[model samples]
Target: MRIRATVAAVTGALALSALAVPAAQAGEAPTYRESAAAAFAAAHGTSDKAAFSTAAAAEMDITFSNFKIAQAVKVGTTNKVSTTVTYTLTHGADVDIHSEDFATGPYIYRGAFDTPDNMLFGDYAATCTDTSATTATCKGNIDVYPADGELLNAHAGTWKGGALALDYVTGDYADQGGLGTTLVQRYSKLTVNASPEPVVKGKTITVTGKLSRANWETFKYAGYTNQPVKLQFRKKDSSTYTTLKTITSNSTGELKTTVTASVDGYFRWSFAGTTTTPAVNATGDFVDVQ
Candidate 1:
C-alpha cells in the first residue's frame, strides 16, 4: 500500500525528498519498526501447541497488518511520535482449534514515542468473534505502551499443529528526545456475499456477510443492532437503482431478502448499510426470478 501522503512528505525530505519524515531521526527517537515491535509484544499470548506443532506454527501468525501516521503534533518544541496500527491475525484450520474466536485478531495502539527507547505508551484494544458455525471468527481490540501496559518489547506466537512461525514483532526501544504528536488512521473492508440463486415465488434467497467492527478499523466507530441490509432489484433493462425489498441480518450476521418479478430478465440485488462498520458498497447482478 502507498504510504500516507502526509507521512511520505514529512519523512521524504530526510531522504532528501520533500515528504513528512517518520520520527526516526539521529538525535534519537524510536524507529517505526521499533515502536511497532513494542506494541506487538504486549498484545498477544503464546500457544503451547504452536511451540511443538510444525504445521500449526506456520499457519497461526500475527503481523502489523496496517500502520498509519495519522497525525503528529509538536509535543515540546520539536519532539513527538504518535501513530495507530491495525494488526490482523490469520489462523489456519490447524490453529483454529478455537475458530470461534478467530475474528478477534486486529489489535490497535495509539501513543507517543519521543525518547530513545522510551515510548510513552498506552493500552491496545480490539474485538474478536466467530459468526459462522462452520467458519470460526473472533475479534478483539488492544492498546499499547505508556497509555496502559509495560509491553515495551516482546514476542507473540501460537501453536496449531506443528511448526514455528513469527507471530508478533519482538524488540525494544529507548525513548530519545524528539517532537511529540498524535495521529489517526482509518481503514475500510467491504464483504459482499450473495446467494447462489435468485428467490422465486416458491424460493427464498439468503445472502450472508458479516460487517464486524473489525471490518472498518480506519473509519469512525459505530454500533449495529439489527441494522437494515437493503436488497434492491431492477429489470435487466432498468437504468436506475430501484429498491426491491429491505431486510436485516439476524443476530447471527445473516440476511435474507426476496425478489418476486414476473419477467425473467436479469434481477439485480444489493446489500447496503453502515451501523457497526462501514457499509459494503451496494452490489448488482442478474437473476432469473421466474
Candidate 2:
C-alpha cells in the first residue's frame, strides 16, 4: 500500500491564545488535554493545574470511541508521512462539539498517558460531524516529518493509541487511553542484479542484492544486517514467482548466491520485514538464456 510522504509536521501551533502558555511552562511537555486546559487557564488568567487535577475535575459529557489509526506506519528517510485518524465522538446533546473553544485530537505514544516518553500527534485538530443528537464521526491527520527530529530509529516499534476532547469553557475534558496499538516501522527497500545475463543454459548465474531500511536518526537508508531475504524466480511468460530459497544478508546487508541457469526468467529478492521495519520486494531483473 502506498502512503503520502509529503505531509506537514506532526505538531502545529494550536490556536490556543497566548494566555494558554505562561513563561513558566513554556518548555514543558504536557499531555494533549493538559495543554488544552492550560490554554484555557492562560486565556483566563489561571495558570494552576486545577483544570486537570482529578480533585477539581468537572463531569465530562464527551468521550471518544472506535478509534481507527493505521495498523502499521512506514516512515522513510526524508518525506513527512501523512495519515488519517478517525474515531467516534459520543457526547451529551448539550455539549457543543462544533464550538470554537472545544477541540478534539488523536495521538500515539509510548509509556504512560499523562507522561509519555514519546508521542506522535495530528498537528490539526479534529472536526466532528454529528451522526445523531449525541454521536458524531470525526476525522483528523497524523503527520511524521523524519527531518523534523520527532523520531529516532529506536522509536520504531509498538505504540499505543489515545484520544482527547477538551472544553475551553469549563476546562473539563475526556481522555481515552490504550484504545489499541499500532506498529511504527522504518520503510524498507531492496535491490537485485543478475550478472552474465546471456549465459548458456545450465551455467551458474551469480545473483547479488542488498536489504536496507530507513534510519530516521541519520535521515538515510542503511543496510539491515542479518535479515533473511527470499530469492525468488518467475518464468518470462508467467506472472507467478516461486521462492527458490531464503538467504540471509551479510554483515553489510549484502546477499550473493549462485543459481543454475535454465530457461529465460526473472530473479528478485524479497524481505519479510520485522517489528521495526516494513516488508519490501525489489524489481525483477530479467536474464537472457543463450
Candidate 3:
C-alpha cells in the first residue's frame, strides 16, 4: 500500500445574541421554544437532562479553543485517537454557576448532529481536567471502526466535530438543563499501487490501482468509487512529474489506465482528495523501456 500525507483545518464561527427582554415576559415563550428545539437537535446521542430554556441558554457562555485530532486515520485499523479541547464556561451575572452546576463536560462527534442520516460516526465523551475556575483541558481516545451495511460509504472523508455541551441543575432550586456549542472535525486517508515494470518502448504499459477511505464502523478502508485520479510520469533523472491522463475508479475503488513507454521513467497515481478524505500520491514504480 502506498501512503501520502495531508492536513486540513476545521473551524467555525460561534454566534451569540443578547437578550433585550426580561425572562418574566409572557411573549418570550415562542423564542424559548425555538431555541430549545434547536439545542435538543444538536445534542450528541440521547441525554436524560432537559433542554435549556432560551433565556438560560443565552446566559450560559461556552467557548472551545485549540481543538486538535489525528491528521491521518488509517482504514481497517483500530486507531487509538486522542483529542484536546479547552473550554471556558460562565453563567452570566445573575446565574451562580457553582450553585446550579451538576454536570459539565464536552461532547465530540463526527457528522451532522441534527440529521440522523448524516450522523454517521461519533464519540460522545472526553475526560476533562480542570485548570481554572471556569476553564479545563479535555482529552480522550475515540475508537474508530469501519462502516458496514447501510453506512459503508459514510465512513470515508472529513468528519466534522467540536460539539461541546454543558449540563446544569435547573428548575426552582436547580433541576437539570443543558446547551451545546459547535466546532469543525475532519479525517481523511488514501491508498495506491502499480504493475508491469519491464516493457518495450512502443508497447502499451498498463497501470492499475485503488482509491479508498477510512470506515469508522468496521475500522477498515473501503472502496471509494467513481472518483477521478491523475496518472503521472517522471522521466529518468528528471526532477518533475507531469500529468499524463485522468481516470475514474470503479465500484471496487479500482483505477486503470495505459501509456506507451518512451524512455526510462517512473509512473504513479495521485488523488486530489475529497471533503472527507485527504489528498494522497502513490509511490513511483520504475519502468525500464527496452
Q: For residues 11-42, could you state the per-residue lDDT of candidate 1 as single tens digits?
A: 21211112221334567744323333332222
- In order of appearance, the predictions have TM-scores of 0.32, 0.82, 0.54
Q: What is the C-alpha RMSD of each candidate to the true structure, in Å?
A: 19.3, 7.1, 12.2
lDDT of every model, 2 decimals: 0.31, 0.74, 0.48
lDDT of 1 at 166: 30
Best by TM-score: 2
Clashes of each: 82, 1, 20
Q: List the candidates ranked by TM-score, beginning with the highest.
A: 2, 3, 1
Give Cα distance to truth, residue 25, candidate 1, Å. Answer: 14
Regions more than 4 Å wrong, model 3: 1-77, 83-106, 110-152, 155-160, 163-195, 215-220
Model 2: lDDT equals 0.74
Candidate 2 C-alpha lDDT tens digits along 1-290: 11111111123321222322233345654444345435333322333445544432446677778989888989998887877889998998777888877788777776555445466666567888889999999998676777766677887899888777776556666767788788989999899999788889999999999999888888989999999999999999999999999999999899999999998999999898898999999999999998
Worst 10 residues of 2 by lDDT: 1-10
- Backbone clash total, candidate 2: 1
